[model samples]
Target: MPVMNPMQEPCSIMAQPPFRSFLVPGQPVSHPDHPEWGEGVVQSAVGHRVTVMFPHAGKVVVNATVVHLTELS
Candidate 1:
């Protein structure tokens, strides 16, 4: 039997910002297309957008400036 090396593939370069400890209070986050899928805490923020992870829906990335969010104590 002969041994073979693993195949490699090229991927797109996505510029992501560093994680910061900041949360806005009473922020409304909604999806660009579907507003009903928008709900939950701000899991992470990147630039003008934040990843909203809901308890029932899951996760949806939305604009931080538009979504009204609040920090949970």
Candidate 2:
């Protein structure tokens, strides 16, 4: 008799499957010559610029290219 393996179901929208990258609000950012946009929440993602809310600077738009993604600890 041959044993059949169980099929795995696809991941749902709510479930963040492995091997995929996603962005969320309230993430830190950095850039040279500018004050650390430390721990700013992502307000909106528009084109190449993303509007982020800093702790003391309030809301400000930053170039998406300038924002470096941090590795998950």
Candidate 3:
């Protein structure tokens, strides 16, 4: 069996109805697990990886599967 790279596969977030509705570029999000990182703007989302630009942490790549980022208005 060949190992499937997440980056090569279609984003699962986009396939799921609920997650697809909200996960978009430029969306405001906050990490619940890492509150100290502060609020961040969604830079990009691909496959299972989401790039978020945080005030204190700069650009950080988070695994969407493990971290449920809260979308803020």
Candidate 2: segments with Cα more than 4 A from true spot: 1-37, 66-73
Weakest 10 consecutive residues of candidate 1 by summed lDDT: 8-17
Residue 27 deviation, candidate 1, in Å?
Answer: 14
Q: Which stretches of candidate 3 lie over 4 Å from their true place?
A: 1-22
The residue-level lDDT of candidate 2 at 21 comes to 25
Predictions: Cα RMSD each: 9.2, 10.1, 8.1
**Per-residue lDDT of model 1, residues 1-73, tens digit only:** 5555567433333454544435543344444445465456666666666777765578766655665454444
Clashes of each: 6, 1, 0
TM-score on alpha carbons, each prediction: 0.41, 0.44, 0.67
lDDT of 2 by residue, 1-73 (tens): 6555577554475495433224455555533344565556666665556776767678877665655544222
What lDDT is obtained when candidate 2 is compared to the true structure? 0.56
Supply the TM-score for candidate 2.
0.44
User: Which is better, 1 or 3, measured by TM-score?
Assistant: 3
Give residue 13's lDDT in candidate 3 (0 to 100). Answer: 56
Clashing pairs in 3: none
Candidate 3's residue-wise lDDT over 1-73, tens digit each? 6788877865685775543334788999999978898889999888778999999899999888788899999
TM-score of candidate 3 relative to the true fold:
0.67
